[model samples]
Target: MFATATRNFVDEVDRGGLLIPVRSLNDSIALLTVVVSQKGFWFWQKPKHVPTDFTLNDILTGDIPITPVLSETDFIKYNGIYGDSIQGSMDATFIHSNMNAAGKDSSKLELSFGSLKKDEVDVRQLLRDTKNSVLDMSHSLIKQTQKKRQVFGLVKERIVTSQPCSVTEEVQQADQCGGTLGFCGPKSPKVSLKDNGSLSKDSNVTMEIPTNTTIAYALIDLEVKHDGHYELCLMSNKGGFEVDSRTQKGLLGVTGAVSNNPDDVSRLAQELKDLSDHFQLLSALPASSKASLLKIVTDVTEDRAALGALQSVLNRMLVEKSANIADVSEAHKQSIQPVLEMLKESECGSVAETECSASLLSALHLITSALDELTHESLSALRACRSPAVLKITQLLVHCLCESGESPASATNVGVLSEDVLANLEHLFTSSDVNLQRDGDAATIQIKQLQKPGNRPLIMFIALRGLHSLAQGV
Candidate 1:
């Protein structure tokens, strides 16, 4: 019954002109019959009458005749012989085996009849081995996929951690850049003493100043002392002074002052004392004094009364040994030093001009007379003054004495007979016949007596002419 059905199916395929020859169809049916009968006998339950001796070798050796029912013309009409197609399908199986072997191992297989026979090939066993290899390869591929997933997860975690670190670093860099641009920073307070002689007790005094602001000028009023315990403090974000603080106390102590040098303080004290004495003497003098002297005193005293007040405050602080007293004195000196320099420049060449020489000389003489009556302290201060005004006066007086060949004994006591005053006198007379020397509290000038009796009259005449010119200017 099976043979008859298979023959009928082949005949139908040939009649339909499917290009499948009956012989090749019969060979395929015989091979399928062999595999089903041998491997799947339980499923079919083969009848006793059906043949069970079929094999692939019997079919290949032509022990089973597979006659083509279709004519050659019919086969050509469908599409040439279909035997090539069957042969190509068989070649594909060998090609698949070669590819699998290449991937599985390095050993080469010779494609020869002897090698094939010598191997005693088993088709079922080969198929089973190939299936097991495929299963093992699939299992290994699944494990490799899982490992890749773990590595990807680690890389993602690292990236997540690194992002915040990079952001933090960027924020720090931005803050530094802002500082350079002068933004977002604390500023120092500018403290000024109030009229009530007290600083505001607020610790964080915020001045409307920008960061890194510089001081243009600082005006400190030391006139009002609080019970002889005056204290001034400056506070700032960067750094500033704090009164009565440990740091400040350390700096103001005796050892601290000595270490910091007190020469500048001493010099400033001397200057202030000299100015105070001069003002005091002038203030004591009656307003009915000489016009030129009164004018000079009024002009300086009216415009500079603050200096005198500051001087008094400084003297008290020095005597009491106040903290940072030198610092206060130095500040005052800096404020007044420029004015003194200007005065010195103004006084130079003041009496050199023939037009204003006499008036300038008279004004200088009045100053000299005032200086001469000053106390020892005042005298010391005046001696320290190196203004050209004082020196020029000495020069003019000496010049007059030389021209007249007469000693004005009254002028010799016009100022303190200090070394500086005597030096000026000597300098003025160095090129003249007059010889100057300090005599007790006065400077004496003596005319040289030349030995040429015949030239004495000529010398007298020149002296008279100089005196006449000076008198005319007066």
Candidate 2:
């Protein structure tokens, strides 16, 4: 009866259009029986020979070859012999399992490939098509397996604990399956930005950004606009700011999908649009109102939204000169003392710290604008002020000018320094104890010590810019 059942199964497989060799079919049945009955024995023994010719007696007596299929070069050469029949069986099994697990009727399982005209068979094309079909089936099986695991509470924990499964083990499993699955896991979405700071829907950059993190970094290809150079910058709060020239732009883009929830998507879009609207509103404000806004901004210490608003306003004012020079100067005078105190305690913070960096940049802009507006008498008084805070502010202004050359479009308006400011800068240059030397059309300022070690080059670069500004003014 068992032999009759096996013969009936093989006959059914053949009738279903699978042309598995009769010997292979018998061997497969024998191997299945051995696997079911002596599972412990078979689990310990890695089958060296393909099951196509093995029998139950061979498995029971441990007479089967112990060679791995992958180690056999001849198996690869003759792969076409068994590949199609084996793959077809696997594909059918996978589909049936998936449909059954999904609570669908598997009785309707059918293999139809439309009508094929009688013609000379291209063996290579046939193999290629079969390989691709198998791959597609494998991918579908993997996805279904993941879904079933999630549904049945068999999902593996991604996080590590003191229990059985570790991250290392999970990684090893992925590595083992990567060749068959094409990848270890799903990839994240990536978005690119052009040099002009416009986001690109299609870009070559590949990086993943987490769903929860509001801030993301991207590589901007400024080649067309910035002398074929690229830049690395932060993207957050609906704006982008360059980090530094030293930071190369590579491996930048959104790494993951956005939220799938429609409400989350809608809310995010609305927030971004609101930020743009706020910037536009601030930019359109009259000069006097903007000056008042700057004053309010200086008083804001911890509110990120307020800081962003102020930064937007300041950026517009610097770029467009929308505010009156006198009004800006007055606002600068009111805010300069506080900003100077901040500078004394700290060096310029990272561009990532939107509040601190934006505030500092805005204050520097106001000071430069004020210096450009100052009368010679006022400038002389500024030189006479000679305080450490004053010196620090001067150094900060010069640094802004020097760094602005790297990104002229986004830099402060330091190019228009008045003769009065230039003379005062020259006085500060001559009086400073740091080594100051000229090397034919270029000035270098080197400082030996700084309150903050990281700020040494910052001060030196700014002082050098001040010297250059004075030279150009002269």
Tens digits of per-residue lDDT, candidate 2, 1-474, equal 111122232333333221221211123222111111101111111111112232212322123332211110110000000000000001112211211110100011111111111111232332343231211112332234223221100000011011121000000000011111110101212222222222112112122212111110111111011121222112321111122246664222222223222122233233323333323333443333333333333233112223323333444444453433343334344443343333233233342444544444444443233232222223333333232223434544444333332222222332334334434444444433233333332344433332322222222232233222221211
In angstroms, what RMSD does candidate 2 have relative to the true structure?
Answer: 33.9
Tens-place lDDT digits, model 1, residues 1-474: 112121222333332221111111122222212211011111111101112233222322223343212111111111111100000000011111211100000111111101000101233332343231211112332234222221000000000010111000000000011101110101212222222231111121111212111111011111111122222121211111113344543211110001121112232234323334323333332222222232233223211222332333332333333323243345455433332332223232333543332333333323322322222222222222223233334444544454454445555453543354455335434323345555565555554444311211222222222222221211
Give the top-scoring candidate (lDDT): 2
- Give the TM-scores of the predictions, in the order they appear: 0.15, 0.17
- Rate residue 78 of model 2 by lDDT: 9
Q: lDDT (0-100) at residue 147 of candidate 2? A: 30
| lDDT minimum window of 10 residues, candidate 1 | 151-160
Where does model 1 exceed 4 Å of error? 1-389, 392-396, 399-404, 414-417, 431-433, 449-474
Residue pairs with backbone overlap in model 1: none
Q: Model 2 shows how many backbone clashes?
A: 9
lDDT of candidate 2?
0.25
CA-lDDT, candidates in order:
0.25, 0.25
